[model samples]
Structures are given as structure tokens and as C-alpha cells.
Target: MKKIKIEPMELNAVKRVYLLGIGGIGMSAIARYYLHYGVPVAGYDRVSSDITQTLEAAGANIHYTDSVGAIPTAFLNREETLVIYTPAIPANHSELEYFRSNGFVLMKRAQVLGLLSSNYKTLAVAGTHGKTTTSTLLAHLLATSMGCDAFLGGISRNYSSNLILADQGKQLLVVEADEYDRSFLTLHPYLAIVTSVDADHLDIYGTYDAVLNAFQEFVSQIKPGGYLVVKQNIAFKPTVGKGVGVITYGFTPDCHYYPTNISIHDGLYRFTLVTPQGSINNLTLGVPGHYNLENAIAASAAALTLGVPTEKLAHGLESFRGVQRRFDVRYRGTKIIYIDDYAHHPSEIEALVRSVREVFPNRKITGIFQPHLYSRTRDFAGEFAAALDKLDKPIITEIYPARELPIEGVTSETIVKLMSNSNAQVVPKAELINWLKCNNVDILLTIGAGDIDRMISEIVNTLEAKENKAINE
Candidate 1:
């Protein structure tokens, strides 16, 4: 890979920007940032999604096809237009090829983020999982108090957007440092938080040790005099340069920052945040789940390190509504409760199941999981099965292959057959709602990081209709 240096002042010279996959969450956030800065933006996506429509509504020119002819004439100027593309896009994409051949400066989305980080005091949140929620909450906390700009991985419920703009004088920026493709290495953070360093994206790293080594490299990228806050019990050790501070946060007392005297009341988690500086007592997180409590602690620690006062931090934590699909509760009724999450990894699945069980111990939990990628399912089939088996009933659906082709002999049955639960079975996505109608589902969890979310509204409507019929009867 060629190393190109982009200075902060050079960004002002670019008259327009184009994105190859503009509808993606991270890409859209970057697009929104440029749009806010008065830069003309146009892009192409494989399909028109809600995010694409929102960007279009906000003055971005977007197209659904990959053809070079669809490119806006104004963006064809190679010198004035900067092209940003997601790593997920295929190399053969016509729009990307056109830009490359035409001498337009093409950059990965991570590189753009790195350039932006240089202009502001960046607080980067990175990990295999938990980074999305932790970063979103940390952004909310800092934005609520001191005010900051943010590019989040997920749409924050509190802000109702992934891109949080700062006031005119605000110089702080919060970013979700994605570990995939080793993208987080590009960032030089003033404050960095690693929530977990679990082995994931093996297709990219090819080994668990490589993942750890990448994280170690990420930790090394923290700027001098910056702070590094990590979750307790994560395997990777920090190799920060001099003047960098390291702190750990989790549920246990050994962590520098932890929660004490935890309790759940009315579906909310209340705890005391015990940090090295001081303790914030009776802090109540607006979101549910045990894993979320840990996330809140990590976010709080990062915020506190940045000089957010204890009172503002506590209020921000309580006011946070959480990110969409992290632990989104679609419906809660006496007959049935339905929740949806974007948990594709086995460790994330295990956390979801354990949190759900902790919240509703007596409820008969039924889980419908669609594996996200062929590579992930093929790699962690047994782990996925074991995680889903924690539920009372497990329903595995066909894999949602985001980029990779289907692996031979690896299907939903691969997980179903390995599940220890006798009630486990493989079901097609089309039949899921119908199956839900016939089954006795006390607590329903729809889990995955793919098109499984497309089925949520239908499932909710069916469940509501069923509940109405029972009420009338």
C-alpha cells in the first residue's frame, strides 16, 4: 500500500467528494461531515437504502448503479474531487475503476478518518466488539457536557443520527475505531479506549495472534500525553509510549474503574461507578442488559478522563437511549416480549443470551439467529451453536453472506446439528414469522448482523396481531 500524507489544510482545497459505498453507516457519517462543511458530495451504492435516501434528502447526489456514466459531471474533475471508498467494495466496481484510471486520488474510508483526526483532539474507541455502543455513549456523554463532533458506527438513539456535529468552537471529535482490515491503525488518538480484543475477523487477520498484534499496534498509536482506557480481562497488553496513561474498567473491583452495588429496577441497570479519581454513586443506565453496564462504565471512564464532571457524566449515562439494534426492544407485552440485536459473533451472542437470561430468568427465551457471513459461520460454527444453546429454544437460519461466497458443507444446519439444545432447528428466513406465530415464545430474540433486521418489522406486526387476537378472545 502506498503511504500518502494528507494535511489538515489540504482538505479545504477539495471542491467536491465522491464515495463508492455512500450508504454504509461509516461512509454515510463521513459523507454527512463533508456535507456539513459545504463540500459538494455525490456517490454510488449497490442499492438505495434508508440511509442513502436520507443523504439524498440532505443534498447529496447518489446513484444505485456502479456505472461510470452515473458519476456527476462536477465530480469528474480529478484534481478537485476526492474519492473515498469502503474496503467492502469489489475491485471491479466500475465507479471505483473510473476514478482510479482518471487519476482521482482514491482513499479508503479509514484514511479519511485519520486525516480528520489530525485536525481535532480525537477520542478513538476500538475493539472487536462493544466499540459501537461504548463510542456512541462516550460521544453522547462528552457532547452533552463539553460538546463534540462524532462519527459513530451505529445510529445513536439519543441523537437519532450517526454523525454528531459539534458547535462552531468545539474541537473535540469522537470516532468508533473499527478493527476490521486493521483500519484503526490509521488513527492517532488523544484518548483511546479498547473495550475488548477478542479474536474476530479471522479472514482478515488469519490468526488470533495477528488480531492481538494489530490491537497492540493500535495502542501504540495513541498520541503522547494521551490516555488509554481498556476493559478489564482483555488479553492484549498496552504498549503505550511514555506520557500515555492506561486504565481499566469493568464489573470487578480490581479494575481502576468499575461498578459497585449493581441492581436492576424496572428494566434499568443502576450501579455506583467506582473510578480511580472518585466514585459516582447510584448511576442508572437508561439501557438494559449486564453487558451494557460494562459498556457504560467504559464510556464513563473515558469521559471522566477527558474532564467531564461527575454530575454531567451521571446525567449523560442516565439520558443515553442506546444505539439502534444493540439491544433494541421492539415490543414488551405480558404474552410476549420481542428484542432485536446485531450480534453476529459468538462472544457477542453469548453476552446477549446471558444478559437476556439475567433480565428475565423465568421467561422461556426463544432465539432466531441468522449467521452474518460464510467465513464467520465456517470458522465459529461450534461456538455459535454453544452460544445459541443457552437459549431455551434456538432457531438457526441461512447464512447472510455479506461478501464471501458460501463455503461448501457450511449451512445453518452446521450450527443446528451442533447445538446442545434438543429444541434447536434450522429454519428458512421466509418461514420465521410463521414459525413464531405457532410457537409459545415468552421472550423472542432476533439476532444477527445482516438482513435479519429486515424481518424485524414483520415479526413485530405478526406478534402484535397475535396479541390483539388473544386479548379480544
Candidate 2:
């Protein structure tokens, strides 16, 4: 792919910048970006969290309250300050409304990211499931090889940070392209990879076909002469225009890039990677998930296409620790093993459950899942139930209800009722820790996309202490 000159967007020089919803993953990355550049940044979140506190510690003037009056005085200057917000913020948010009423220049997070990426050699990874890990791995490969910068959806266990900024000019920019709100359409990337087009976000998309259409639109925005790496079995056909080459990748033979000679030894997966240039054998991943092998293949293929050698790809893959909350292992012992993952969608949940079953076939798997959104619980209740029913024993928790208002008659009870497993029960999040303390688990797993992650440490401690006491007795 020939690199085209990216005309830089004019950035306003400001003394103080106000972020209306600085707590979002994407918004926080941008906040870090500006703060790293010595820009004075401050913001308000509806609640305080570890992420918000980290931003606060990093010199961002952060407040949990939503009052417009709480905004710093310096950011109130209409002429010099810019207000950035996320689409997740309610339409009637006081701070957002105040910024608009007061003549402040305001922009969505996507628009700002698009403007920033437009000035760089952007490599955008868009998908339903694997965008975070794939983009983070790609960034790791690029940053470790050719100097690069990245904006990631999750904190990299390697960097211990979500935002990876390079001091040098934008030789490469890796971004996790978010499909929510169709934010990825804003990026005109020199390289793009779509891992999956599974039916998701029905609240916004309404149908599977609409979800595919949004992906097609994302492909159209890819710069001409660039490459599009798509997962092999997606329903949509690539309608990329002339000069853009479509490459398919999967476990299948017809894929332009595929994995071969796959094997797992002592929980480590080794595979032979076949690219157009040649094949590399015995490639190992630092992460343990069998599904991650395919993710690594996609990332490595993109890296190889961008001129990274196979050896460097292998080295980077070996060193890649993985993004936080994606099959993150909190505790591992001889008798009791605890794994916590961020798997909200049914497909993701099934994958996590299946992988755990594969790793420990003999042990009885007890999974505790917290449903994420009310819309999703209402939409895919049957699917979620079917997936959770696969485990030996499953416990369903009340829905997290992130952004959407709770729907009438829609709750985790809906999913639990549909499950065939008699063990599946709707448990409150508050009682989870106490329940874990009494329960005897052979292989314990907590899967969710919400605040279930906040309970990981307590769950791990409880399980570990139980195991220790059992061993001593």
C-alpha cells in the first residue's frame, strides 16, 4: 500500500481544555494524549473509578460530580478552551448543555480522534470481539520494531497504560476502531483489519444486516491502495473500491493468511503462520486462549504486510502480555483455578467458557456471569441462556445496566429462566463476594463486561485463601 500524504487538521492552541465525559475509554485515551503533550486538561465523570483516579493522578483536574459550576474557571473561557464529549453522555447533560450554550467549541470524541489520526499513518483495527487485543498486539509489534504510537481500548499489561504515545513523529498509529456510535467511520486508515462482523449492538443497529452495512461503510472509508484484512467467514462481501486489496484470513485453507501445524503444550499454543511472503513455524503466544491464536495470526499478518520480519513478529508475540480483562487470570493453583474475563456478548461468553472447558476438562466449571446492558439482555436473552447452559454449573447475576435505562420486565432473571442448567440463578452483585467465600470451586470463572471486573481481586483472594486452607488441613 502506497502511503498518501495526510493533510493535518488545524488544532487550536488552548490554555485549558474541558472534557465533558472524560471517563470513557476513548475519551480517557485522548485526555492522556493531550496531557502527555503538556496540555492543561480537566473533566467530570458521573462517578469516580480507578481509571478516573489514574487520570487525576496524571495531572488531569478530574471531578466526579456532574455540575457545570464545578468546571474549573480556566476551562470556562469560551475563546481559549475546547469541550470534548462522548456520545454515551446523555443528551441533556448539564455540562454538555452548558458548554454548548456558552459558545464553547465542542466535538465528539470520534471527531477529535479522526482529526488526530488524519494527520498520521493510521492503522485501524475494527471488529466486534478482538479489536482491543489485536490492535494492542499490532501496536506492540510496531512500537517494538518501527517506532509507533497507539490509542487502545484497554490498558496493555505490557505498558500498564491504555495510551501508547511516541515522542517521534507519527511513523505509525494503531487505533482500536470502535463500532459503537459508528465512530470508526471517521478514520481514513492506510491499513484496516475487520476481525468479525457478528450481530451486536442491536439497540443501535436494529438488525444483523445493519451491523454488516455499518462494517461495509467502515471499509469504504479505508484509503485507496491500502489493505483490508477480514476474517474469513463473515457474511458480508467486501465492496472495497479499486486500489484496495481484500485479504481473507482464518483457520481455513483458502484464507490469504492462515495458521497451520497448531498444537497446545502445557497450556501454551504453538502454530505455524503462513503469509504470502513465506511461512514461520513454532510461533508461540504469550497468552493462553486458543482463540487468541487466530488473533495473533491477524496481527502478525498485518505486521508482516507492513514490512515487519517474521522473527520480530514472533518476538513481539512472545512478549505480548495481553490487554487487561480479556481472559485475565487472577489466580492459578493446583486444585483451584480462577479466571476472570470481560465477555458480555454470547459469542464471547461461549468462547471463554469453551476455552476454559478445554483447558480443564476434568474439573467442574462454575461460572458467574453478569449481564452487561439492558438492551442486550432484552435482545439476546435466549442466546445468553444457551451459552451459559454449556457450563457444568453457571450463576447469572443482575444486569449491569451501563448506559441505557432499564427496560420493563428485562433483567438477568430473563436469561436465567431460559437456561436449562438448574444451577443458574440471578444473584446480586453485592452478595457475590460472600457467596464465593463459601462455595467450593474446582475451576472458577467470572465472565462479564460490567463491574464484575471490580470484584476480581476479592474473588481471587477468597479462592486463594480457601485453597491455602484446604492444602494446610
Candidate 3:
């Protein structure tokens, strides 16, 4: 395939922009960006979601149907309109086909991001996991002190938006470098952070070694004199170019940047950040979970590297409110507590379960998990089962096939059967909410990366109603 490079200045000529999957987290950020630039924006999504509605309210035209006729006529101009589509959108999508057939300039979402990043000093966060939280926190840190533009994967609660525009005269850019579809390779970052190199997206890489190779390639793309901050004990050794620097950070003391003297007070984590420059003592995180502490360490390291003052870093970490759906606490009461998270991978589930157990040790934790992808479920069923077995009671729902067709013999039962927890059972998606209503849930956790999030409002409402009824009784 031939690559077509479009400079950032060329975007100024575009009067309108159309997106195929505009409601996606990444694609929506780009939509918001175009809208911010005063361009007329419109897009098609498979469903009308809160995100899509938000976009509509912000003046971008959106439609739920996928027909070509549904596209607004204003976006049909071939020379004046640019079409951006997510990779998840099917190749045969009617609107996508119309744009391609009509000679409109079409680009992938990653390509558009690459063009935008090239116009500034891009700081990219890439990994199999933790990239969203790390990148969002890093954006918060930089935005608070020096002002930066950010393209985040998850919506930051602090800012209430995923796209953060830079203040005038600030050339800094922070982006979440997605590993899926080898999208991160499009970015040539001035600074990069590799949080972890876990084997994932096997459908894309085919083997674990290929995944490592891709990360190594990503490291090599850093511009000369750039810095690469990586997590301690990552398997891939980066081949950094001359004048490029490497730094490691983790919870251990050996890391150049780490934390020590950890303690929790008033349900929050307080620890001293130990860095090569100096140690910041008695710092507290605004979010919960020990894994989040590690994410904070990585974000702080990146900020410090960029010459953000220690005081600003401390304030940013303490004031950060965390991202939505990462570890969102929906409800808390004496009778029942409900939490929701976007953790579909086995390792992520393990960390979430462990953190919940640490926070509420005496309570019975009931986990309701919906597996995300067929490939991922088939690839990591045993690992998923093992992690879910840690919960006091586990409810497994059918797989949510995001981009892939259903695989024979690969279902939620695959993991349910492998789990050692005798309380584990396979529940259909239709019956999951009703099943929860009938049960006595002490600590409720809804964990997955798919449509499971759509059910959170109902779960919270039901649980809240239950708590209110009990109180009145």
C-alpha cells in the first residue's frame, strides 16, 4: 500500500469533515478536534449513544443508520470534505464505500492523528495496558502547568472531555499511542512511555515475539534526542538512537523513578515520590487502587522529564479525579456498593480484583464480567478463568464480539467451566440485570471493555433503589 502524507496546513482548506465511526472514543476525539477548528462535521455510527448525542449537541451532525443516503449533503463535497474512518468500521460500510467511490479524500483515524501530532512536540504513551490512565494523567499534569493539547483514549473526569486544546503559543501535544492495527507507528514522538509489553492482539501480531518486535520498532521511531521512559522489567530492550535517553520507573527502589514510604489515609494513597532529581514527600493520589499508583508514577516521570516543576506535579497528582469507566465507583451504601471498570484482559482483571480485595477486604466481592472479543476470549480463557476465580462469586456473560465473527466453541462457558470457583455461572446478557436484582450483592463489580458499560446506569439505579427501600424499612 502506498502512503499518502497530508500536512497539517492542508487541513485548513477543509470546510467539512465526515467520520464513519464517529462515536468511537478515538474517532470522537478527532471529531471534537475538527469541530473545535470551526469545520462543519458529520458522521455515521451503528448506534446513537450518549457520546453521539453529546457530539450532536455540540453542533456536529450525526446519524445512527449506516445507509449512504443518511449522510448530510454538506459533507458530500469531494474537494472540500475529508472523510476519516476507524479501522473497526467494516470495509463494505455503505457510507465508507460512498466516500471512497466518490473520490473524497479518505484517511484512517491514525493517519489524521499522525498529521496533527507532527505539528507539535508529541508525547505518546504506548503499552498493552495502562496507556489510557497514564496518558490522561500525563495530559492533566502538563495541561495544568504549561498548557498542552491532548488526544486521550478515555474521557478524563477532571476535564470532562477527551480532547484538550492547547492554549495559544503552547506547542506541546500528548497522545495515547494505540497498539491495535499498528497505529502507534504512525506517530514520531518527541517523548514516549512504554508502560508494559504484554502479549495481546494476537489476531494482529500472530505471535508474542511479533508483539515484542513491534514495540522495538516503535521505540526505534523516537526522534533523535528524544527520551523513552519505560516500565521496569519490560521484556523488549529498546534500541534507542544516539542522543536519545532511556529511563525506568516502577514501585521497586531500583528504578530511577519510584515511590516509597507508602501509606493510605482516609481511603486514599499517600506516598513519597522518589526520582533522580529529588524526592517529593507526603504526596497523595486523588484516585484509588495500587495499580493507579503505578500509573501515577509513570505520568509523574513523564511530566518531570518535560521540566514541569515538582510543585505542579504534586498538585496535579493530588487533584486528578481519574478517568470514567477505568475504576468508576457508581454507588456506595451500607448494604451494597457498585463499581464499574473497562478491564477485559486477564492481567487487568487480576489487578482490579486484587485492588478491590485490598480496599474492601471483609466484604464479599461479586464480579460480573462480559468477555470482550472472541479472539481474546479464545486466546486467554484459562487465564481469565484463573483471575475470575479470585472473586468470591463470579458471573460470566457471553462474549461481546466487537470486530470479529463468532468463533466456534469459544463462548463465556469456556471460561466458566475452567474457573475453580464453585459459585461461577454463565449468564446470558438478557438475564444478567434481572439475575443481579434477585441476588444479594455485597460488593458489585461490572468489568469488561464492551457493551457492559451500557448496563451500568441500570445497575446503579437498581442498587440505589434497593438501598433506599432497605433504609425506609
lDDT scores for all predictions? 0.89, 0.85, 0.90
Better of 1 and 2 by lDDT: 1
- In candidate 1, which residue pairs clash? none
Q: Which candidate leads the pack in lDDT?
A: 3
Worst 10 residues of 2 by lDDT: 1-10
- Cα RMSD (angstroms) for every candidate in the order listed: 2.8, 2.7, 2.7
**Model 2 misplaced stretches (Cα beyond 4 Å):** 1-12, 167-170
Model 3, position 102: C-alpha lDDT score: 83
Deviation of model 1 at 279, angstroms: 2.0
- Once model 2 is optimally superposed onto the true structure by TM-score, how far is the C-alpha of residue 146 displaced, in angstroms? 1.2
Better of 2 and 3 by TM-score: 3
Candidate 2 C-alpha lDDT tens digits along 45-83: 888878899999999999888897798888888777778
**What's the distance in Å from true for residue 70, model 2?**
1.3
Question: Candidate 1 overall Cα lDDT vs. reference?
Answer: 0.89
Give a tens-digit lDDT track for model 3, residues 90-145. Answer: 88888888888888889899999998888888999999999999999999999999
Best by TM-score: 3
